[model samples]
Target: PLAIQQTISVYLIAYAAMSIVHGPLSDAIGRRSVILGGMLVFTLASVGCALATDLPTLLAFRAVQGLSAGAGQIVGRAAIRDLFHGDDAQRLMSQVAMIFGIAPAIAPLVGGWILGWAEWPVIFWFLTAFSGLLLLATWSWFPETHPPDRRVPLAMRSLVRDYVAIFLNPRFQRLAAASSFNFAGMFLYIASAPVLVMQHLHLGERDFGWLFIPTIGGMVVGAYLSGRAAGRMSGDALTRIGFVVGGIGALIHVAYAALADPFAIPWAVLPLFLTGVGVALIFPILTLAILDMYPRQRGSASSLQAFTSLVVAALVSGAMSPWLSHSTLYLALGSASLTLLGWAFWRWERNVCQRLPACPQETTAVEPADPL
Candidate 1:
C-alpha cells in the first residue's frame, strides 16, 4: 500500500470513515462496552486483512477493521480523563502513552516477522488473538469508567451539532488543525515508509519491521520525556519543544535524503527515525491542547482531532505517494519539512497574535481553554 501508494488511501478512508460514528457511540454506550466491541470487530477484521490476497480485498476488509479500530484510539484517553484530574490526567496519559508507545515500533516488526516466516494470514490471526486478549482484559479488569448517570444521549442531530460546535470553536479549530497537520506529517511517513524500506533500501518484509524499531524508539523516548516533564513546563512550552525536535529531525532527514546515493539504508532512515521522534514529541501535546480547548466534549474533541488526523493523513498519503514515487526523500522530507514550517506559524499564533489561553480547568465539562 505504501509502495504503490494507491492502497493506502483505503487505509486512510477506513480510518477517517470510522471516526465519525465511534465517539458518539462511545458516549451513548459505556466506554467499556463500546471499546470492547470495537476490539472484537477489529480482531476479526485483522484476520480478514491477513487473508486478503489483493489490494481491493484488503481494502474492503480494512473498512471493517477501520470501524472496529476506532474505539481504542478514540476512547483510550477519554477513559483516562474520566478517571483522573489535571496533572493526574497528563500523568495517566503519559503512563498509558508509555505503555501504548510500544505498539507502532513493535507491531510492524512482529508483523514483518510473521509475514516472512508464515503467510500474511498469520498476522491477522495474531491480531485476532490480540483482540481477544484485549476484550478479556477489558471485561475482567476494566470497569465502567463512564458512569451511566453521566452518559450523554446519542442522536444523529446531536452528533452533527456536536461536530459542528467543535469545528465552530476558533480555539478548538486552531489546536485541532495544527495537530491534524502534525499527524498528517507522521502518517505520510507511515504510508510511505514500507516502500522506502522495501523498495528503496532493498529490504525484505521482515527487515521492514526491524526498520520500524528506531522510529518507534524515538516515539517512545519523546512520549516518556514529555509525560514526565509536562508538570515542570507549560504544556505550550513542552509542545513547542516537541515540534522543534521533530523539525530538526525532519531537516536532517531531508538533508540525508538529498545527499544519498542509491539507497544507503541507514542514511535517511536514521533521520526518518528522528522524524518519528518529532511526532512522539508532538502527539500528547496536541491531544492535551485540544482537550483544554473543549474539555466538556472530550470524546467529541478527541474524535474530531483524530478524525482530522486520519483524514489529513489519507489526503496527504494519496497526494504525495503519486508524486514522490521515485523519491523517498522528496516524499518524507517534503511533508515533514512543510509541517515544521507550519508549527512555526502556529507557535507564533499561540504566542503573539492569539490570546494565550489560561490553564484549562480539570473538570470534564466542555469549556474554553485559556483565551486567544
Candidate 2:
C-alpha cells in the first residue's frame, strides 16, 4: 500500500499535467468517445498494475491510470454541468458524487481485506476487472452528451484563452487555492497515515479501516446537515463554517504535537474525524461555487481544481512527509499549516469579492466570484 500511495501520487501528477487536454478533447471528439477512451486507458493501466512486479512499473502504470481517472472525474463533472445549470446542476453533481463516494467508503474496507487475505497483486486484478466492466458499460450504453452542434474545437488559442480566463478570474483563483489548500491538508494526512499509523504506531491495515470510518462518518454528518440547512444557509456560509471547524481540528492536532503528545490516539483520530466533516461541508459548497463561475468551461475549471489540489498533495507526500519523520512537531505543524492557509484564503476571497460589480453574491455583504 505505501507503494500504492506513491503510485497514486504519480497519477495525480500526470492528471495535473494532462486533465485539461481531455476536457477540450472531449469537446471536440464527443463526450462518449472521450469517456470510452479514458476508460480504456484506465483498464489497460489496471492490467499493467496487475502484472507489475516492481514499484517503478506499478508507479508508471498508476500514473497512466491517474491520468485516465482525472479525465473521468472532469468529464463526469462537465457532462453534468452541461445537462443542467445553477442550483439544479449542483444537486445533480452531488448525486453523482454520492454514487462515486460509495466506492471510496467501500474501497478502503475492501482494500484492507485484500491486503489482509491476498497479496498486493490481487488488488490490481480487482481494479483491472472493475475497470473492464466499466469500459463495457461505457461502450454499451453511454450516448454522446456532446452533440456535434455543441462541439468546441480544442485549439491552442482557445485553450490559452480558457486558462487565462480562469487564472485572471480572481475569485476563481482564490476559490481554487482555498480548495487546493483544503485538499493538501487532507492528502498530507493520507500520505502520512500509512507510515504514521502502520509503521510508527504499529496499527494493522484493518485497524486503519476502522480509523477511516470516523472521517467518512464526519463527512456524512456534514453532508446531511448541509443539505438540510440549504434553505437557511448559503454555500459560502457553509464553507466558512467548515473552514473554522477544520482549522480548529488541525490546530488541536498541532497542539498535541507541541505538547509532545502526538502519539496519543485521540490526537490523531479526532482531528482527522473533524477534518473529514469540515471537508464534506467545504467540498460540495466550494465545488458548486467554482463550477458556477465558468459556464462554458466547467471541464477546464474542474481540471484546474484537480490539478492544483493533486500537485500540492503529491509534492507534499513525496517530498515533505518523508522528510518530517521522527519529528512529530514538524509533522503536525506542517499538516496544520495547510489548513491555516486554506482558512485565510477563504476569508480573503469572501472580502475581496465584496467590491465587485453586479455581484451575483447578493448575500448582501457576502462576496461574489469573478467571470468565467
Candidate 3:
C-alpha cells in the first residue's frame, strides 16, 4: 500500500515540478506544437508503462507520463487567453471547466471498468490510445494560438529573467496565491478522502461516488452560472459571491461536524457541493487575472499559476491533510482556513490594485472589477 502511495505521489510531484518547464516551452514554440509533442510523449510513455516488467520501470514510465500530461491543460489555458479576452474568455473558460469537471468524477470509474475486463496494463493501453487520438486531433485541427511575433526567445538568460520578474512582481504573486489558497480549500477534502469516506461517513470503498458526484454536480452548475454571468457580473463580484457561498458551506460543514449525532451521508457531504460551486466560480476569473497580468508571456504566467496551486496542494496533501484528517472538525477548520486566507489575499490584491500605478490598466478598463 505504501509503495503504491509513493508511486502515486511521485507522479503528482513530477507533474507539478515539470509544469514550470512546459509553460515556457509553449511560449517559445506554439500552443499547438507543444500540446502535440506532450501528447506524443505521454502516449509513448503509456506504452512503455504497459510493457514494463518491473515496478521501477513502471515508475519511470509513470514519471514520463506525468511530465507530459500537464502540457495540454497548461497550454490549453494559455491558448484560451491567447484567443479570447474579457467576458468572452471568461465564458469559454467556465464552459471548459464545466466539461473538465466531469473527468475527475468519471475517470476512476472508467479505470475500474477497464480493469474488470483486463489487467492493469490495459489501463495504460487505454491512455496510450487516448493520448494518441488527442495528438492526431491537435495535429490536424488545433491552430497555432501563439503567434511567432509574440513569442519570447527561449534563451537561458531570458528564461531566468522572465521567471524572476514574474515571481518578484507583487500583483502576480498575490493573484497566483489567491488562486492557490482558494483551490486548497477543496483540495483538503480530496487529500483526506480516505478518512472522510471510511472514517467519518462510514462509506464502503465503492461508495466513494456519494461524495464526488454531488460536489462535481454543483461545480457543473456553478460553471454554467459563471458562463452566464460573465459579461453581466464583474470579476470581483463573482469572486465575492463565491467567497460568501463557500463561507456558508464551510460553516455548514463545521456545524454538522460539531452537532451531528453520528456522521452520515448527504449531510456530511452537503457542504462540499457549495464549496465546489464556489471554487468553480472563482477559478476562471482568478485564472484570467493572472494571465492578463502578463499578456505577452501568458504561457509562463499560466505555468506559474498552475505551479503555485500544485505546490500548495502537494504540501497540503503531505503535511496539512495528515494533521487535519483525524476528525471532521479538523478538516472543517482546514477548509475554512484556506477559504478565509484566500479571501484575504484577494482583498489585499484588490486594495493594491486601487492604489498601485503599476497595476494593469486593462484589468479595470475591460471589466471594471470591483475593488473588493
Q: How accurate is candidate 3 locally (lDDT)?
A: 0.82
| TM-score against truth, every candidate | 0.86, 0.84, 0.92
Estimate, for each residue in 1-372, the C-alpha lDDT of model 1 and write its tens digit: 353344445655776887877776777677888788888788878878878889788878877886677788788877877787656676667666545555655766786678677866787788889888988898798887887766667776677767877777666666766776765665566656677777787877767754566677777777777677756776666667778877877777676777767756666567656666666666666576566565555677778878876766666766776567468678766667557755964675486434333544334333323221
Q: What pairs collide in candidate 3?
A: none
Enumerate residue pairs that collide in model 2. Answer: none
lDDT of 3 by residue, 268-315 (tens): 988888988988898888888878777777888888888888899898
For TM-score, the strongest prediction is 3
lDDT of 2 by residue, 1-372 (tens): 566567766776777788767776776677787788888998898899889888898888988887787667778877876777555655555555444433445566788889898988899899889989988987898776767766666767767777666767778778878877875775566667667667656788787664566666666666666665554666667777888788787888788767753375755567777776677667666776776666556666777776767677777878878887456678777778888888788788878764222235322111212323
Q: How accurate locally, in lDDT, is each candidate?
A: 0.68, 0.70, 0.82
**Residue 274 deviation, candidate 1, in Å?**
2.8
Q: List runs of model 2 lying over 4 Å from the truth.
A: 1-9, 53-60, 95-109, 137-144, 260-262, 354-372
Instruction: Give the clashing residue pairs of candidate 1, or none.
Output: 246-278, 296-365, 296-366, 355-372, 357-370, 357-371, 358-370
| Residue 151, model 3: Cα distance from true site in angstroms | 1.2
Ranking the candidates on lDDT from highest down gives 3, 2, 1
True lDDT of residue 143, candidate 2: 72
> What ranges in model 1 sit over 4 Å off?
1-11, 47-60, 97-106, 352-372
